[model samples]
Structures are given as structure tokens and as C-alpha cells.
Target: MAFVNPEREEIKGLLEGNTTIAVVGLSDNPERTSHSVSQAMQQRGYRIIPVNPAAAGDILGEKSYPDLGSVPEPIGIVNVFRRSEFTPAIAREAVAIGAKILWLQLGVYSEEAAAIAQEGGLTVIMDRCIKVEDSILRPDIRRI
Candidate 1:
């Protein structure tokens, strides 16, 4: 069967329930989409964990981890900014680290990865921007 994401309402609840987002492939550069989006989420009261292997230091004032498994705290979501071709491995890592959600950023998706994440008990969201979704779901609320 083709992969299907959770309903809009369910997605909203997912956002409500999960406040910590581990961003895979997050960039240290403020000019990057990953950086801007993650920063926005952080401003919305969601904790952002940077998971870039090549990170020079922290991103957005939070210590950067090389991967999801390396993150010391529990992760609520794994938001991926990497290419579609790289998602399956990231999915496995998310699953391994017990993340509750695997979110593929806009224009990035992999059926194989989605299936892997779903089978591993993670809610899978593909080709969507988490910051946009959060803005749509909770427009009335902004932490900062």
C-alpha cells in the first residue's frame, strides 16, 4: 500500500504532544532553510536539537549532536532536512533512538523511509514543513 500521513487533526495533536524536535541535517548557517525553520520552531517553544554530523559547534545556542542516537535527551520528533535518498538511514536512526515522529522537510521524501519509520512505530510526515504546520495549527500562540 502507498504510504499515507496522519490526518490534519492528528498531526495537530502530534505537534501538541511533542515539544522536542531533533533536526537532522540542520545547518549552522543562519542563511540555510534548516537553520531558519528550526529557529522559528524554537521560538514557538519547541526544543530544537541539531543533528548535523559536520556541525562546527552549537546551532541556535543549543549543543549540536552528530546524530539522533548521540542526543542525550529524549527526542519527540526527527525532522529531516537531508535529501530523499538519505532518509531511510535517518529513519532507521530515528527508530533506533525511539523518536515519536519522523518528519521529512518540504520536497524531501522516501517511501522506503516512511515505511521503515511507520513500521518502527513512528508517525511519519513527508514533504511538509514543520514550522508551517505548527504556524497553521497554533497561530494564536507564539512563545517568543
Candidate 2:
């Protein structure tokens, strides 16, 4: 079966309820899309938790964890910036960490990943830019 993303209203409500995001494959470099997107989310009042194996110490101001399981606090959303092939493992980790949402960034998509997250009771959104969705759906949130 094919995978489908949540409706616009559902996504908007999920974003409104969750203020924290765990960004997997987040890069330390400011030029990377992950960094910029996360920065924008942070500016919009969402907490950005960097999850990367190679990132030096921190990306943005938050402490970086090598994987989702390493994160200490509860994760509201697991936003992945990795390639399509790598998302299944990320989804498993997100499920293990009991995250509510599994969001695959723009150009990233995996049916297997979506199935895994969905079976684990998470709302799965693939091949979309979280930043763009937030900007469009939550117009009340002002950028700082």
C-alpha cells in the first residue's frame, strides 16, 4: 500500500501541540538545510534538539545527541533530514523513544519508514518541509 501524509489541519494541530522537535542528521554547518530549517523552527518557539553522529558538539544552542535514543527528555516530534534509504532506522529509533510524530523532510520519503512509525503509533509525514508547513499553517506564530 502507498503512504499518505496527514491532512493540513491534522499537521497544523500536531505542530501546535508539540513545541519540541528532534532533528536527526542535523549538521553543524549553518549552510546546511537542516541547520537553517531548525533555526527557523527555533525562532518560531519550537525547541530544536540536534541529533547527529558527526556534528561536533552542538547545532544551534541545543546539545547534540548521536541518536534519538540518547535524548534524555520526551520527544514530541522526530524530524529527519537523512536520505530516504536511512529513514527506516530513524523511524525505529523514533518509535523507541516514544515520539508522537515522525516527520521526513523535503525530498525524503520511505514507505517502510512510514509504516514502521505508523505501526508504532506515531503520525508519519513524509516528503515535506516542516518549516514551510509551519509557516503556512501557523500564521499566528511570529518569526523572531
Candidate 3:
């Protein structure tokens, strides 16, 4: 069977309920899409945890971790900026860390990763941008 993303209502609920988001493959470069998107989410009041081995340091004023396993707090969402090929392992790690949502950013999608996350009891959103979704679903946040 083919995979389908959650409905808009469900997605809105996930965004409304979740707080801290672990952004996998986040880069320190402000020019990077991950950095911009994470910054937007942060402006909307979501805590962004940067996860990148090469750039494991302060990023956008938040502490960075080498990987999801190293994040010391409970992660509400695992927002991925990595390639599709890399997502399954990230999904598995997100599951291990007890993340509620597995969000693949715009232009990134992997059926294998979605399956892993779904089987692990996580809500999955693929080929979508969390920043964009929040702007659309929660207009009140956009005003801020």
C-alpha cells in the first residue's frame, strides 16, 4: 500500500501540541535552508535542537548535538533536512528517542523512513516544510 501523510487537521494538531523539535542535518550556515526554516520555527516559539556531527556546536543560539541519541531532552518532533536516502536511519533514531512526529522537509521524502516512523507509532509528514505548515495552520503565530 502507498503511504499517505496525515490530514491537515492532524498536522495542525501536531504543530499545536508539540514544542521542542530536533532538526536533523541542521547546518550552521545561515544561508542553508535548514537554518532558515529552523529560525522561522524558533520565531514561532518552537525550540529547535540542531543535530549535525560536523557542526555540533552553537547554531542559531541553540546547542547542537552530533545525533538524535545525544539530545538530552525529550524531542517532540524530528524535522529532517537530510536527503531521502538518509531518512530511514534518522527515523529509527527518532523512534528510539520517543519523538512524536517525523517531519521530512520540503523536497525530501522516503517511503522506507515513513514506514519505520509509522510502525514505531509516530505521525509522519513528508515533502512538507514545518515553517510553511505552521504559517498556514496557525495564523496567530504568523502575526507574531
Candidate 4:
């Protein structure tokens, strides 16, 4: 399957329009990338929903869920922090839960997962860091 980087307009629209981000694999430890990124997004006015089975009870002052389906609110984006091999399951769940976008964090890639997301008509971004992209592309906006 072919992968595409969303245009500036699309990314801008997503950044401006969507506020809730489901961070799958989010960790409680502040040192972790997931925590930092999620925290950054939260500071940027986005509602960060941390999804981790181990931390199902809490995270970032919000109740964490076991998975995307467990999240009660509408998810604008599903930002995955798991390895590439773990993405298809998350992608399926994200699509099933009606997420508008599936974002695999930097160093993550999954052709199958991306294909599944794209097939379900959800916008997919792989091997990219949302924080860096937002910071570089939208410099005026501080990420935390």
C-alpha cells in the first residue's frame, strides 16, 4: 500500500479542529517519550487520553483506558507509541472506534497497520513525531 504525508492544509486543519488525542501505550513515567509527548499535547490545549493496560486506572489526571474502544469520548486521533508489530491491532481498534486519524510515533512503522487504517478511510501517519512536526510546522504554537 502507498503511504502519503498529509498536506499542510490537512495537517493544519487537524491541528486546529481536533482537540482530543488518544495516546495508546502512554506511560506514567515522565521520562518516557509517550508521557512527554502526551503532556506536551495536553499543554497545547488538547485532551490527552492515555491508553495503557497497566495504567488503566490513571494518567495525566485523567482516567486511562485499556484501549481505544474503552475511551468514552470521540477520538480525533489515535497516536500509537507501540512498536510497528503492535500497530495492526491498535489500528483495527482505532478504526472500529471511529477515530479520524491513526498516528504512529517516530521510529514506528507498519505497512499492514497503515493499510488497514487507510482502507478504513482514516488518515494515517507513520514514522513521525507529532511534537516535532507541530513545533516545526507551526512554530508560533508552543508544544508544552
Residues 1-144, model 2: lDDT tens digits:
788898999999999999999999989989999999999999999999999988868679899998899999999999999999999999999999899999999999999999999999999999999999999999999977
Off by over 4 Å in 3: 142-144
Error of 1 at 143 (Å): 3.8
Superposing all C-alpha atoms, what RMSD in Å does each candidate have to the true structure?
0.8, 0.7, 1.0, 1.5
Ten consecutive residues with minimal summed lDDT in candidate 3?
A: 135-144
TM-score of each prediction: 0.98, 0.98, 0.97, 0.93
Which pairs, if any, clash in model 4? none
- C-alpha lDDT values of all predictions: 0.94, 0.94, 0.93, 0.88
For residues 1-144, could you state the per-residue lDDT of candidate 4 as single tens digits?
377778867787777777889999999999999999888888877899999998857789889998888888999989999999999999999889999999999999998999999899899888989887776666777545
Instruction: Please give, for residues 16-69, the per-residue lDDT of candidate 1 as tens digits.
Output: 999999999999999999999999999999999999989958899999998888
**Ten residues in sequence with the least summed lDDT for candidate 2:** 53-62
lDDT of 2: 0.94
Model 3 over residues 41-105: C-alpha lDDT tens digits? 99889999999999956998999999999999999999999999999999999999999999999
Against the true structure, candidate 1 has what lDDT? Answer: 0.94
| Candidate 3 Cα RMSD after full superposition onto the native fold (Å) | 1.0
Q: Using lDDT as the measure, what is the rank order of every candidate, best first? A: 2, 1, 3, 4
